[model samples]
Target: MKLRQVVPWGFTAIVAVLIGNGVLSQLTARGLTNTVNEVMQGYRVQTSLQALEQVIVDLQLGERGFIITRDPDFLRPYQTAQSNLAQEFARAKTLLQNEPAQLQNLNELEALSNEAIAVLSNNIARVRNGETPSSEELIQGNQVIEQVRVKVAQMLQAESQTLATRKDIVTRAEILSAISTLGGTLLGTLLGLSIVGFVIRQVVQPINQVTLAITSSSTEIAATVAQQEHFATEQATSVHQTNSIMEELGASSRQSAEQAQKTATGAQEVSQLAETGIQAVSYTLEDMSVLKAKVEQIAQQILHLSQQTDRIGNISELVTALANQTNMLALNAAVEAVRAGDSGRGFAIIAEEIRKLADQSKNSAAKIGVLVSDIQKAIAATAIATQEGTQTVENSLKTAEGMAQTFTGVTTAISSVALNNQQISLNAQQQAIAIQQVVSAMNSLNEGAAQTANGISQTKISTQKLNEAALDLQAVV
Candidate 1:
């Protein structure tokens, strides 16, 4: 608005940028410091674990030498390792005290180390007592020692992973710090240069313009009054154009409001439709789940029917066997009757009929068995098909669930759209009111221009007294 405000505001912008950069740098530096500390701590703990592993190896070597050679002199390294191992473990634990997970691992490592050392002690004591250590005990010690080494390796790997993560964080922090510093420098430099350029354009260049305008204003008062009247008339014309445009804008704003309301209503309808679709999908999913259960039941029933068919077929086979036996007995009876002559003739006929009936019964049982076998096959196929139908229903249930979720999302989006449209309608209505106010302001401005023209006529009369003063000011310039 004025050249006087540029200096403070421009310098303030530069200062704000510097302050923001400093704050960001401070934050990055703090984070970097913390990560560096963690990295350093990790290295320390890793060193301690390596040293502890070495001590364990030395102890194992010393124990083996003493066991084989029976030389107590070999016990010297073992003793030294025993003392150093405890210190190393304590140091590692101290360094990792802040990390609960690492501390837990270290505790386990310490426990295994102690157990291995205890077995080693027992072996050495056996040699001193003039007794040979058992092969089992020796093997147990070696295995436990190996476990210690493995635990140490795992701890080292964990530390390494943590260190790698910290290193990445360090890299990112350094990059951000550099970017903030460089960007702040560039921004400050550009702002300073712009401020200088603004001074030249807004302040320095305008000084000459002001001097020229002062020199040009030595015109006669009559022409200045006429110019004022012409400006007033043009301002009135411009106000008339502005008022017409504002009226058009107001009408457009009202139309926009109506359109926004219609859009909001459509969005609301869409939201309702989405909700209805979601409910339909939910019902379909429920029905599909019920259908899946029903199909499963049907499959089970088909399986049961197949089992019953097998039982029925067995019964049919038993019946067929009994019928064959009965037929054989009847044949024997008919032969006996024929030996009795005329008195046994009726018995022979009756036996002959009994044989025929037995044969018929056997044939009927055979047909029933065949029918049962076919029914079993049909039941088996039905069972398989029912399983497939169950699977299909399950899949359809999953799909329906997905569609229901999709409909839920659509409903949420439509609700948002409806809300946005309502907001747009409200804003349009507000803009229409603002436009009406602006039109009224334009009318007032037209009246202000007329008043300004009248004031200028009075100013023209007053300038007659200032003619001598203008001459004096011209000499001073």
Candidate 2:
């Protein structure tokens, strides 16, 4: 049959056999094997110790050869021995980590090696110069070598006994460790097989069913989300329409407010015009008053001129009376001359000349009266012109006053209009403020709507993620 089909039974038997040979029942056999292995390792250690001892002997021989024959060929063996000695010492140290006494022996060996180096150097120098070696020095060096060899041999025998004893014990321990490891392996294998069977039968089938259900639910959710997208589009269209209507309303309100403001400004200009007209009328009335005062002064001058004309007329009448009296006296003198005859003729002639002089004076007085009468008539005419002028000025003043009154009425009407316009302006300003408040509220609403939309979008994304997480957990379960 197939090896996979045979593996479980075959492995079981192998595990059973290993457990039978293990430490649970074979302590004595394990101890013996351990003792044998320790003996073999100790034999290796002893061989290394012997090699170090031989290096010392070679070094001594090299000294003796230099001292006796003075040959460089003999020193070659000494150098080789020195190198071999270092190698052997390192090998022994690594192998004898638990042997404290052997390490002490190694320290003593190092001292001997150093002594051999000194002795060889001296002997070589002396022999090369053709000097013969002393027998006593050669004998002493040989004795040191022999002693070192004996000590190495002793250390080797002792380590060999210890290694043999430990080897037997190690052999038995190895058998027991093999048996225990085999028993653990068999138990672990059975448990692992049982776990695999349980996972396949109990966990995998249910998880597959749950995954199928979750996939069906996710498909339905996708259909619902497509419907929600259509709804969202309609909602966005509605919001846009609402925003457009609000913009129209805001524009109309702003236009109305501007028109009202223009009307108020026009009313204010009218009021200012009325006030200016009243001021002009007032100035005209003041000028008319000045003209009336000047006319009154002219009338006074005419009255004074009439009084002077009347005085001149009276003086002319007095001159006429004086001329009449002079003529009568002259006639009386002529009558007396007729009665006196030839003796009164010269006096009569002088009286006749006086009568002519009186007549001329009378004529001059009459002319003066005419001149005074003309002056009086002219004064009366001037006075009449002044009266007419005064009446005209009075009429002008009255007209100016009436015009002023009309201007005042216009001013009053303008003031009423200005007050009404101020009220209208205040109402318009209040309406504009109300509209501004509405605009501000609309802006706040727009901002809030944007924030709300963003929050809703984020929430939708988070919900999708949460659904995914639930599906993942459902899969895991």
* Candidate with maximal TM-score: 1
Q: Deviation in angstroms for 432 in model 1? A: 64
Worst 10 residues of 1 by lDDT: 468-477
- Candidate 2 least-lDDT 10 residues: 1-10
lDDT for each residue of candidate 2 in 380-445, tens digit (9 for 90 to 100): 544554454455446545644664575466446435533543453354344333322332344444
Tell me the deviation in Å of residue 394 in model 2: 2.1
The C-alpha stretches of model 2 lying farther than 4 A from their native spots are 1-255, 428-477
Candidate 1: lDDT over CA atoms?
A: 0.63
Candidate 1 global TM-score: 0.46
Q: Each prediction's TM-score against the native?
A: 0.46, 0.37
lDDT of 1 at 63: 88
User: Which portions of model 1 show Cα errors greater than 4 Å?
Assistant: 212-477
